[model samples]
Target: MATLLHIDSSVFPHGASASRPVTDAFRRTWEEQHPQGTVIYRDLATDPVPHLTADAHLAGFSDPATHTPEQAAAFAARVALIEELEGADAVLIGAPMYNYSIPSTLKAWLDNVILAGRTFMAEDSKIKGTPVTIVASRGGSYAPGTPREDYEYVQTYLRAVLADTLGLDVDFIVPELTMAPQNPAMTELVPLYEASRERALEDATTKAKELTERLAA
Candidate 1:
């Protein structure tokens, strides 16, 4: 049976969050394709993972036998998070843009899982080539040719870490201009937002089914 690691870092709930509904769509489709498959879920907003501490950072580079009690405890927590990523066949993340970047909760999760000589900087990493789909929702458009394109750090930063560094096969479903409906000044962009959102939902469903089929093959 396939295992999916589904993570949602949106501060808002399903109805209010731009990224959560799209991720939920993808997960629902994946579940339909694999009725008995396992899903490991994390809601980072409510139960955020610990930030990388000095002990945790040092533990990754030091020998296990040399770890002090503090390092041992911190590294154990880090290992549990890393093991979750290594064990998953696929990963889905709801990464809503906050201040033109990813949520700090998501960053904290990455810091814990991205260990040197293990998930990163390793030739034969367990998570290498694992499929990962990121739903990157933003309040305003920062796509190519947009005025704020250069400010789009969420995807750029995540790609650097999740794909380039970790060797995961990364794909993205972006829903842009999310504040159009709520913000009076951006009322003109509401139609565009709707279109983008619809497209994201379709992409999520299609990608989910495609990944399931690929995994079965």
Candidate 2:
């Protein structure tokens, strides 16, 4: 059976989080297609992983025999995370924008798994070419020609890391203008937000089904 690594970094729950429901939609569709498949899930907001430390950073380059007690503990935690990514057939992430960037918890996870000679540039990397779907929900529109297009860092940074560095086959489903319904200043954009939400859910379902079929093939 196929395995999926799902990571959710939304500070809010499914009912309130713009990104959570969309990612949940994708996961539901994926599970429906692969009833017997495995899903290794991580809810970063509730159970955040430790941030990458100096010990952990240096341990990746040093010999195991030379590791200090601090390095051993820190690096061990990172290894578990890396192993999860490597073992997955596909990955799904809920990375809602926080202050024009990804959440710190998600960034911490990335720092742990993105080792130089392991997940990044290794000749025998397990995660290389693995398919990854990212749900990048934001409070405002940042598409090309948008007023805040230049402030969009989530997709741009992730594409560079996930595709350029790790060599994953990356795809994104974005739901924009999420704050329109909640923020009075953006009340006029509510319709656009609703439409974006609908499109994102549809995209998530479609992408999940397509990925399952491709994996089975």
- TM-scores, one per candidate: 0.99, 0.99
The clash tally of candidate 1 reads 0
Candidate 2: clashing pairs of residues: none
C-alpha RMSD values across all candidates: 0.6, 0.6
Least accurate 10 contiguous residues by lDDT in model 2: 117-126
**152: Cα error in model 1, Å:** 0.6
- CA lDDT of 66 in candidate 2? 100
Worst 10 residues of 1 by lDDT: 115-124
State residue 119's C-alpha deviation in candidate 1, in Å. 0.6
lDDT (10s digit) by residue, model 1, range 88-204:
999999999999899999999999999889998888899999999999999999999999999999999999999999999999999999999999999999999999999999999
